[model samples]
Target: MANVNTAPSWHAPHAGFIRVLVGLFTVAALVVIAMTLAYPGPDPHTIVLVSAGISLVALNIVAFTLPWGRLPRRHTFWLALAQLVITILLAGTLYQTNNAIPLLALIPVLWIAFQLDWPHTIAIIVALGLGCIAFWLIVEPMPSRPRVIVAISVFYFVVASLAILTQANADALRRSRAIAEEAWRSQQDALASAESNAAVMRAIAHGVDAAVFFASQDRSSTFANQRAQELGRRMGVSAQDPTWAGHEVYGPDRVTPIPPEDQLLPRALQGEYATESLQWVGEPGAQHAVSVSSLPAVTEAGEQVGAVIVAHDITNLVEALHAAESFSATVAHELRTPLTSIVGYLDLLETDDLDETGREFLRRAQQGVTSLSAKLRELLEPFEVAGASPTFSFIDVVDLLRRRVNHWRESAGTRGIVIEGPDGSSRLQVPLDRELAERMVDAVLSNAVKFSASGGRIEVAVDTHENSARITVTDHGLGMTREETRHAFERFYRAPTAIRRALPGFGLGLATALSIAQAHGGTIRLESAAGAGTTAIVEISLTQVGVAARGSS
Candidate 1:
């Protein structure tokens, strides 16, 4: 892993003031040294005075090179103290020779004022004052030059005071800058959050089929997605408006206009949630399932604001439902007559049968006709009541499967297909309608027999547990592809291979079988791969309610 740097970069200190002080001191020290060297006094203190001047020059040079202001507070204080002591010692030596170098004391005072806090600066000032007093007593200047000493001391005090004021102003500016930077960062974060929220809203608006509108508190629209815009054009008005072109908006009946108070947008503005299916009457009629939900656009405290309106076009779904209902009715009307006639003829033949075998054949034919009529009725019933519940009974589900498998065996044997069932006592008690269970088993068995090739084997098994019973059917047949198996239970869906082979089926057997299993709180799973055969498993929960109907006869 690459190393990450987390530490803040070091900031160099401001050196403008320190540089000016160093330059001034250097010039003053050189001039003083030249004057002392040119004019030696009677005591001839030339070497001592020149040495002090050279030391002052060297000290200022060090001060100019180092970043004294950037050092720690205590280190800076000690450095300033060293400069002050050196300056005091040099000036005291000059005064001992009567060289009149009191102005040098001002340098240390200025350094202290700029670098140290108020308390330390004040302490240094007092110490410098005492040193001046000692100079006045010990080096007692001549009566004519007393004014010079007083004037120089007063000048040093004034310069130190000015430095303190400058430091105070600098501190204030630094604080102000820090606050401004914090506010700028906060504003940037807020802008980023707003942009993220806008992106999410845009994605939601464009991704769904629903038409969305964002409006202000004054009921003016601020935004509408592509779908909403299209919907508005279709309705012959702008999407911003709840109604357009004086067009009447009617309820589900499409006759009477809905009350204005009950309208979706109007109710939402009143802080009420509203949803309704409405029809727009125009040259070409349109239908919408509209919902309006309001959320107050408030600050931290609660307040009411405008609402968001979502309109969905469910016209295609509604039309498809109507078409399916019509088709079911037509199928029932067409099949009823023929099926009734067949059942009547079979019933009559049962009475006129002569031999035992003939009688048995007639009985089987009548039963088959009866089962077909019942299936037709069950299929048509759903078009009227979509979720109508099934009638149930207490019966042995395993026995029901065995009987249906046996019925299909003779037909399958004719094509050289073998039907195998579970060995020994195929009796598992469960609460389910005997006729419906039989129908489900017969449907699955029929599909297996139809799809299996000659000499193929169809294996059937039933296993019972404490909570549920399972029936499995495995067939070695012309299997289905992945896509075919996925849609195998869809109504009227036949596998491509089956269609190509011209298999005899209406494609409703597995669909009806799946429906029956689900209605009894069960599920059917089909697994198959191309050219690898198929396995069908049906599981029914035995503890489902509404199983208290009459027992199977």
Candidate 2:
């Protein structure tokens, strides 16, 4: 990106004007001082000479301050305004002091006209001329006042007229050059685009074991390679019609007509692009999936010229995706039945009359059921995400967090773990989904409480700011190594330490939490060391009103 550089190339030409101004003023001041010392009295001619030199120096200074050559645009406008006031003052003084030097005022007038557009040029000219006439009336002139006045007035009028003409001609020339350059560039761009497109089409045709062709506005084939013609013959298409019509094409297997849906050649002739990823039925049970793309060819003026279509066979990819989805659905369904029965029996056993040993056995059975249910849910969750609608609403994040913490506190307490949270002073409102956000927070905090050693603390803090909200959960217990932390959020990726420590978790907590955070336009990040502790931070924006209300609530 091109920004206003603080320091530009030192060799820039605009500095020349400033240097000239400085030199002019320095030389003029020295000469005026020397001459004043030489004369030592009030002589009109000498005074006029000194005044003229001073005015010349001021003119140069005004020019220097203007956006004369290569200054940045913003600074140019500001400096130009300052220069304008100085120019008006100097011009008025020169006109009043000596009629002969009034012609010098025309220089600034012409300069203004050339540099800026018409409105400002006209305004400056009018102001300078009116001010000079008014000053002439006020100041008593020399013996040749009428002639001098007439001469100066004519000079200004003639110069102003010539300046306007010159400006118009220069503008016209610039516009003509710009238009010509734009046309030339467009031609070059179009040629490059055409060459690129041809190369891409050729490469695509070569990569696939199929043919591709493009047609032009004149109903003539613009591009068709040897492979396309060969494919035409194999598909029983007449090679004569270079842009394939809906004619029968004989492949190695059998005779096949281009499907009614894929009449790309006909559409191209009518100046419309067509696309199809279709399977052509050949023999009784023969079909092959072919991916086809079509695009309308247009000119620089946006005139539709023709169309190009490329077809590539992708039957294998389509089949593989279908098979995968089917297998996943079947596996998930099969596991659900056995899981339901086991959970149901555990529920019954836990509720029935039982002794101490029986109660302990039932509790273990229920824990197993809970773990199985979680694994089953994890396996099925991704499929639901595909169809899940993105819905957002205001939610009491603190209240929700509290409920989840309370629910998990009992389980963590059994292992002698402590969970800490925000005090009553902290704000805990955020915009998010109730169920998804709750589940996500629950998963992360649960893992924190689970992994922490007996009596170790799991701290939860909710920090709100003007633009965002942060939820941090820190656990002081067995922390992960670098490699483990890197892949900690990956599904089913249990760390060696975590697995060896007899912690019962499916390792989907981080992954699910990450998904939920992302859904709410938030992120979950972790900071941890091997033995130090782990901190999980969830940052979500408070840009939306719903989010703000929820967070505030």
lDDT of each: 0.69, 0.65
lDDT of 2: 0.65
The weakest ten consecutive residues by lDDT in model 2 span 1-10
* Regions of model 2 farther than 4 Å from truth: 1-332, 345-364, 382-386, 544-553
Task: Score candidate 1 by TM-score against the native.
Answer: 0.46
TM-score of each: 0.46, 0.39
After superposition on all C-alphas, the RMSD of every candidate to the true structure, in Å, is 13.0, 22.0
lDDT of 2 by residue, 227-346 (tens): 555444444455466555634422323355555344555565666665664534223354555555678878899997777667666658667855765665578779899989888877
lDDT of 1 by residue, 1-553 (tens): 1122222222344466667767787887787788787877776457876886888789778877886557555455554555565555556556645445666666666566655566777767776767666555535545537675775577556756665775576467556756766666666666667777888989989898788866667765467789877765654454445532224455666566666666555666666665544555333354553333344455466654556767777677556755865786688878989998998787677665369999888878878888778667755643333354566767776667677778988999999999998765656667776666776888888888888999999999988666678899999998888899888986667888888999866577788788888878888989888887888999888776234443322
Clashing pairs in 1: none
Number of clashes recorded per candidate: 0, 10
